[model samples]
Target: MITAAPHTTPGVLDGIVVADFSRVLAGPYATMMLADMGATVIKVESPTGDDTRAWQPPVREDMATYFLSVNRNKHAIALDLRDDDDLDTAHKLLAKADVFIENWKPGGLAKFGMDPEAVAERYPELVHASITGFGTTGGAHLPGYDLLAQAASGLMDITGEPESSGQKAGVAIFDVVTGLHATVGILGALQERQRSGKGQHIAVNLMSSALSGLVNQTSAYVAGGVVPTRMGNDHPSLAPYGPFAAADQPLILGVGNDRQFRQLTTALGASELADDERYATNPARNAHRDELRATLETYLQHRPASEWVEEFRELGIPCSEVFSIAQGVEFADEIGLAPVQLTGAEKVPTVKHPIDYSRSQVAYDKAPPTLNEDRQSILEWLDAEEG
Candidate 1:
């Protein structure tokens, strides 16, 4: 575990409070980001705890790493909302909170009187953000898992090789993307609230976030009248932009434009290739990608990937030898990015939040809590507020 420089300054979001009733990935991830920015996030779980508490096997001590990954810098209290006392506690928490977030199924929280409509009516000054698998309209009944969103949103359709079946991303990408979208929406609403002195409902769903996150791929079909298909690692538009065989291992080349192409060919001692009409311009190079790949490999075959990576980088060509996750972390550290932080009393290792600010710092003062670990303190605080 790597330790980052300690931040002594107050957080940018020091006074903001968030009531987080989200379980699993999307909602918790968003709340975690808020917590990192110094929001006092209270994670309200069910009596059984968050679902990720049981998603173990990759464990640190008795805790699930998956749960730990996104629950730090927050206090936790498990509340059985079915009971009147616990439901009242939840309501109290919301009364003091600036933001409320949940990922319950559409109408799932209505029975508890915690749905968006009810919350909006009750606490008009509190920003309420909802994350769902699908929208609350026609697709509300569909389960909101990342895999299902990937399948439904054309991500799976365009992933993998031309002949093989589509593959889900190694991680729950849509869930993370949806969380980021929720975070942005919540922040935007909070800013708007400063002006209007009233908060609004912010809704984000996995399927919509997935389609938007697809960016250029979806733009092709929607704007350019082209439906893209699977091409393995190769880009649909950019040529000479995928992994190529070096003498020992594969090297990824991201030669995006004519200049990079020229730099790449010249570095390989194949300067004449830059003059070839079929491989000169981006459009022409994309049209002759296969031939260009074959010709590039003929020159690349003389050197190992590592050697080519060094030379191409010096020549201002975008290239890299593939790295495993471990190596990736090491590389980040090597470049002076302290990628991990040992947080809280137990010194649990956590991947640090990726942003850097000049005035305020990201918080890593608390570790992810055990189930309902903060119940006594939270309850005392709530009772004291009532008193």
Candidate 2:
């Protein structure tokens, strides 16, 4: 993706306007991607503000960090859809926009006069991108939240220690996944519009995206007839392929084949164990993985995880020290991921949008707005449009 450098901008979607009706993580994440791609995003928030605005004590400039994480690079406009004037203004904005994004319940928008088909009917070429708890089809009745989706789709069932009750992933994996799928749908619909000169209704939901993301595990069940189970830090099928405790800390390693396993054993100077039938080939090793893990841990516990990482990397094994969120950001910078964008230096340590387009950018990074911050100015603009 093109960098949102002030001096040089590709502006692929420069003329396009996106009327953002979504809030919170998934919707905002999708719009942020769109804004970064150069669309003008006007965030239409409810009057009390996005619920996330006051989400926590970890505030930046006294504003919630939860709010800051996603609502960047867009103009904020608060609207009470129940009020006729505000609803009229919203309709006006939608009529002129190239895209409309929302995260309401299946029939929520229809009640508000903003359903996808209605918007498409009014603006045939508008890309109506929606993210929700579930799709409008079979799972429509279910609520859409990351944890709930995880639990509903069986992801939580395979996430924790087998002996313990399954746990949700540490992060809102399903919400973020839905956001990404939303973006994909929007972009694809936009491309189709280029060809047919008419946009289509596109949607994604946490529940659907969560199920889609369980590709490997689901494929195993459907194709191989195996009900996958929680194995804690261990791989679903590959044994001795998860986190191991070194002398100082836990480190993860991906031993792909017998050859790599041999290399790992040699690194530990325990090659003799590989020849033993109990730990010989991959399958045999997997079958007796507990025994192999015990033997490996005995040797690994003699060295620091950091030291093990260095040597394991050199052995062409995929391994790394598990990092906390902060450490992950630091490591990303060290390896050129540059995941953090230091706009205004340390004052705004924002996460960069993942996609980088050579010929275009999403939106420029802008701070989140205060409640009703854009109300006066937005009303003025709408008044001017009417005149």
Question: Which model scores highest in TM-score?
Answer: 1
TM-score of each: 0.97, 0.91
- Where does model 2 exceed 4 Å of error? 1-8, 344-347, 358-364, 376-387
lDDT of 1: 0.91
lDDT of each: 0.91, 0.81
- For residue 301, what is the lDDT in candidate 1? 97
lDDT of 2 by residue, 1-387 (tens): 112232246466666678888988999888877777677778889988898898888898888998888877667788899999889889988877788999988888897779987887888999998887878888788877788988988998998899989998887888888888988898888889999999888888887798789999888888999999988888865756999999999999888788888888889999998798987788898899898898899999999999999998987978999999999988988999879764422347678778777766544455566777767766676566667
- Each candidate's clash count: 1, 12
Query: Positional deviation of 141 in candidate 1, in angstroms?
Result: 0.2
Predicted structure 2, TM vs. truth: 0.91
Give every collision pair in model 1. 133-144
